[model samples]
Target: MPSLNKILLFLSSALATAISVLVLGFSMSIQWVETTMDCTSSGSSFSNGSAVVTLSLFDGTMTRIHCPFFGGQDDFEVFPQLAGIGGTPLVLHGLVVCVLVLCLLFSACSILISLYNSVSNPYETYMGPIGVYVCSSLSASFSVVVLLIFAVNVNNV
Candidate 1:
């Protein structure tokens, strides 16, 4: 039978790996940020409707949901504004995605190391407890990086 420590390591690593995958999926598919504004009461004759902006953090894309924005009758005019945003917020969003990717990778490493170490002769060095701890800590560190970058991106955007 496997040792209690081995079993615990295997279970914790497995759970971390699964959670990482689900979070990555959500990051890619779900809308990360959204803002809606009512321009009708802006004391301007031309501004008559609301505007909505949605952001996809994973891809650094900003989408304008409302057409003919600011009471402009031509819908295609706003198309140019829908292009990928540039500058600090864009860089910040990219950083968030990259950190999350790193987090997922480290989580996978931890799970593999746990399985291998538990099943075989656990190495006294990196392949043993050291490997699992390093991978888990790196994963956690990347998660914190992602949060900080995302917060900066949202604030700047």
Candidate 2:
């Protein structure tokens, strides 16, 4: 049987990988939306209208739809200024994703190593547990930071 420590380490690593994947999915989705009012050019008889605007972080695009109760629908696309406004957040998010992938890979390796150690030399000491702890912690921290950045930046947008 594998040691209790090894079993715990494997579970922790698996949990970390699952959490990282979940956060990555959220970070890649459209994160913000806003509505605004617009007026028509009918002189004194101007009509009120509303527009729905959405910002997608992964695609770096702003989509707008003019949905007026009295007129035909109009769609507008504003090219995302990736380097202008979203540069910092995008870079941070990308870095977090890379770290998460690395952590997942490391965790898988650790699990394999643990299994090997258990079967081949059940009495010997191995570094798999230490690696699992380190990778899990690092990935969790990165995920939290990425979430905070997303929340703040999305709110601002």
Best by lDDT: 1
Give me the displacement of residue 156 in model 1, in angstroms. 1.2
Highest TM-score: give the candidate number: 1
- Model 2, 2-31: lDDT tens digits are 577656655565565666656555665544
For model 1, the superposed segments whose C-alpha errors exceed 4 Å read 1-5, 39-47, 58-85, 122-126
List, residue by residue over 1-157, the lDDT tens digit for candidate 1. 6677777777677676667768766776776666675555445567545666565543323333343433332223222332346667556666776788888888888878777666664343237777778888898888878877777767876
lDDT of 2 at 130: 71
Please estimate how well model 1 matches the true structure, expressed as its whole-model Cα lDDT.
0.65
Q: What's the CA RMSD for each of the models?
A: 5.0, 5.7
Candidate 2 lDDT at 67 equals: 34
